[model samples]
Target: MDERFEIFLVATPGLEAPLAAEAAALGWQPVVGPGGVTITGGWADVWRANLWLRGATRVLVRVGSFRALHLAQLDKRARKFPWATVLRRDVPVRVETTCKASRIYHAGAATQRIERAIAEELGAPLAPDAALVVKVRIEDDLVTISLDTTGESLHKRGHKEAVAKAPMRETMAAMFLREMGFDGSQPVLDPMCGSGTFVIEAAEIAAGLAPGRSRSFGFQQLASFDAAAWETMRTAAAPRPAPAQFFGSDRDAGAIRMSLANAERAGVAGLTRFDCRAIGDLQRPDGPPGIVIVNPPYGARIGNKGPLFGLHAAMGAVFRERLQGWRMGIVTSEGGLAKATGLPLESGPVVAHGGLKVRLWQTGMV
Candidate 1:
């Protein structure tokens, strides 16, 4: 029987269910956990998960597992597990370990133990910041080792050449759209759309564009990665034509320019209409009531919270006065700022984004 490897969909803890649903949509049976979801799949499935999962921060493939009672047994077994299958001997690797209720509770010392074992037994070189990293976890006498198939977080889709102040990540934007039940049909608007991340992600979704189509991943360096198969998959997953269904505006002309450039790079510029306008110009598009998602600046970046209070008040007034019955999703780190909207929204799940605890308060179901 072919070995079924464990695939982990790493996220910011609260989004595990949404990420799991995305994985399951791709035909992977995802078992949701606290911080991520685990599934059993082959090498090809692993590649698909990384390439297509818009909500996952990273996809880790479990390489091997065993019961190691002591440090010696871990070192001995680590040597025998054929690291060459996934890691090249010439390429350096960094060992990271996490222990919980296990014999090896000291993470730093345990990492050193595994590092020395690989260097001495397998002749693998160790670097301070290796392109490849092996993550080891010990829980209840069970040892599970996984390789970081995604060197950096998958959210770095490699397209945004520049970023504005307080920009949102592509993965988080896509997940937010999904959470708001975006089906890629209705017109979506992002007032205060800095660099157009939310609008661009929505355009990509509407056009069936693969998130990783224009990027490179660490899996390309692995020995087990089939180049021909990957090429075939890439060709098959090329971006399709997106209907003109995305709109966005920012008060800053610089942000609008950046959004246009990013949209051009993503090849969805024609599908999105970004303007150098403010929230006052926001009007209902030519369609059924659509979703409006915005990530406005809080006190952290822009200015004193005192001035921002009036801005939030105006935002609430505008939504109620003009955009009645339209779904509104506002991402804000400050609860007081969100409350300033006064849109009958007192509850929403908290999301950790960019080191800030954010909430996606939605009101007026479309």
Candidate 2:
């Protein structure tokens, strides 16, 4: 058994640093790579990462790699590779291949070759929509094989059933929170909290709940998975009490209801509060200074960008006047809208969100 393998923590492109920071905080020596973070660990580490990592979109295990300049050589190597060690004979797998600057440039042909190899050698059924995925990359004639340990994106934490329009993904929200310097001790507030993503995530982090606790991972279907070990690891961490309460307020009553329901399902209802109120009605809660993070409407998905200037200006005015000593993190698509707030916000990196590029604008204590 290969105890040590290369682990890839797939992160959203612009947020790789926060994901790497998260991996490092979890005691993994993370090498910042393009599009993700890389670590070297065993099957146990793979399991733990799928269970504990909040910022990673998916966890991929690099099983092995070899140089194959031609499709025939790739097929031979693929058939001889130790597939039984990682894949189960009973579970079906889907093979996805990509080729860049390589002699075997036809990805479809390469995928078919690998699929035939797996079926003949390992006797595993190949399905188009299989839960398990075998990812192959042929770049510069270097073939690398990896397994997607996460069936669904980690953003689907299995608790948030109801979502508002243009909702921020939980994975992106986690990275944004990390970028905001949230340490899980102070309170968090999302004024335009659609479905309570940021508040609930913060509450969960403060409560020491694993993001993957409510979900099942693709690694559970692998041959190397130990049910008893996984159960032990999942139940090892006891939930902690949050030091402060998290808050979410939205003008839509339906959104508030959804937020409340989602929070209850996530086991953070006691630590979070959701209210139905507009941005102008947002009042400072009774608590010590904390971070206020909001993913407001950016006009691309919600409405016209014209009237949003007044809305941003109103929010900026309220935060600047009332929320003294509270730090603010605003995620928006337009830099002008972020500037309309009239707050001294230093722009962060532009990240991809729902096909549109967005940036996190942060301000010091207001």
Best by the TM-score measure: 2
The lDDT of model 2 is 0.93
lDDT of candidate 1 vs native?
Answer: 0.83
| Per-residue C-alpha lDDT of model 1 across residues 90-153, encoded as one tens digit per residue | 7788988999999877788778878887787667799988878899999986888898888788
Give the Cα error of residue 212 in candidate 2, in Å. 0.4
Candidate lDDT scores, in order, read 0.83, 0.93
How accurate locally is residue 27 in candidate 2, as Cα lDDT from 0 to 100?
Answer: 97
Q: How many times do residue backbones clash in model 2?
A: 0
Model 2 clashing residue pairs (backbone) = none
Off-target runs (Cα >4 Å) in candidate 1 are: none
